[model samples]
Target: MQKKAGVGFYVFLVIFVFVIMFPFLWILLSSVKPLSELFGDQAFTWFTSNPTIQSYISVFTIRPFHLYLWNSLVVATVTTVYTVFVAAFAAYAIARLRFRGKAIILGVVLSVSMFPQIATISPIYIFLRNIGLTNSHLGLIIPYTTFALPLSIWLLVTFFRKIPFDLEESAKMDGASMMQTYFRIILPLAVPGIFTTAILVFIAAWNEFLFALVINTAEDYKTVPVGIGMFQGQYTIPWGEISAATVIVTIPLVIMVLLFQRRIVSGLTSGAVKE
Candidate 1:
């Protein structure tokens, strides 16, 4: 009976993995196939007789794709760094210190995080325009950090709460100031959670389309998603090139997940189990 159950579990796992991976596999396959084959009547064909790197090459030549890639990296990196920095202090305060209206503050943070981005777009646009920040990296970076903060704070707070208070008290007794302990003890112990949250922030900022599109009208400041949208031809869409660009854009995220899968899982599940 145990053997049969194990076999059943393996079958289910295979199906689940395939379901999740099929779309990416399809996109990767499509990216390599020549346009002649992609647009041909051989619809739904998984493999091609001939594969070419033309689409990948064209993705860069046809547009400022390198600039788009760079923009995404910079914006996402800055947003993640700022969000983590700010959220750390906020989380440490909320989780480790006794403060007034802590519950209220946390509730507000969560509620604000839940607010729809679409609903706030116009007001943000107006504010950025008024401040003369339109079509700039800082313009997007500020808002991305703002939008990413709530969730970062929430995650860090949970991880912080899971840490033993005795360690902090011990540090305090050793003539270490709050900032010193935070830097030496808390940050070190919370690396998993911090890295996990950073990855989430980076991915969110990288893939963000609406704000990137609305905030930066120029081709120079566009991110990969928005840049890929401009790959359209006169009459038909450039599926091959679009797929290639998508594959390129998605590779970094895939690499991040692969590299940090264990850290992410550990961080997410850290506070769930208590001694």
Candidate 2:
């Protein structure tokens, strides 16, 4: 019975995988096709015959893809770094220490996470504008980190609780201070969780469009998503070049996820099952 169930699960997984991958496969194929073929109705039939990379070159020649790439990398990297550090410390304190209103604070974090980002956009925009952060990278960075920080803390707290407090006690007994314990023992064990959180933050910040569009007005400051959208006008969208850029953006996330698949799975499952 167990063997039969395992085979059935594998079959289901294979079908689901194909279902999810087909559209992306089609997009990738279309990206390499000529604009004429791409814009034509029978473009799907031309997928196997000829593939052209001219569309990829056109985006760079016609638009500032390099600047967009640089902006995305910088913003995502900064946001990831800030979120991981801030979230780790917050999670540690919440998980390991006893304090008044701790439950209430956690509840508030949960509530904030549940709030729709779109609903609060105007208020955030006003606040950022008032503080001279509007149209600056720091403006988006601050808010992205703030919005992502809560979920990071929540995920890390779940992982932290799985760690034995006795390890912390042992460090304390060995003449190591609280900071020492955090920096040495607890942090090493939490590396997997930290990485998972960083990837999540990077992906979220990288894909964010509304906040980036609203806060960053300059061409050089625009992230990839906004940059790509700018390619579309009222009448026409460059499907060929747009598809190529879409594929380009997806590759990094795909590689990163595959590379860290084990760590991500272990961290999430451990946190969920044990915590």
Candidate 3:
């Protein structure tokens, strides 16, 4: 009976993984297929006979896709850096220091994230326009950081709280200031968690569409998501080129996650058990 159950569980797991991975697999296959096969009878086929790299070449030559990629890299990198830095300080304070209304403050920070982007975009747009930040990378970065902070803070707070207070005490006895202890001892110990938070924040900022679309309408500042969205021509949609662009943009993120999967898992599971 147990053997049968185990076999069924494995089968279920395989199916689950396939379901999750199917869209990406489809997109990847579609990326290399020719335009004729894409819209022809092979539209729903699993594989193509005549695959071509023309779509990949066209994505760069026909449009400023490389520029869009560069824009996304810059904005996401900047947003991740700023968000993680700010969240670390804020999280460390909440985790280590005794303060009034800490729970309320954390709750408020989380509630800010719960607000729908559509609901807030109007005011945010107006504010950016007033400050002359619209159509700039900073405009997108600022809002991305704002939305990313609550989750980063929350994640970092858990990691910080799990850190041994004895370490901080020892640092204090050794003449370390609060900031010194944070930078030298606590932050180093929390590298896994910080790295995990950074990856998540970077992915969020990279794939963000609504803010990218509304804030930065210029070709120079458009990111990958915006660039992919604008792949339509006057007469027909460029599905082949869109697929190639997607494959290009997605490869980097997939590689990053695979490379750091161990650290991400470690960060998430580190403090789960009592020592």
Give the per-residue lDDT digits (tens) of candidate 3, residues 24-116. Answer: 899999989988888867899988888889999999998899999999999999999989998999999999988898999889887987878
RMSD after CA superposition, every candidate: 2.4, 2.4, 2.9
TM-score of each: 0.91, 0.89, 0.89
RMSD of 1: 2.4
Residue range with the least summed lDDT across 10 consecutive positions in model 3: 266-275
lDDT of 2: 0.82
Instruction: For residues 4-106, write the lDDT of model 2, one tens digit per residue.
Output: 4678888999999989988788889889877778665767574645778987897788778888998888888898898888889989999998888879988
**Candidates' C-alpha lDDT:** 0.86, 0.82, 0.87
Best model number under TM-score: 1
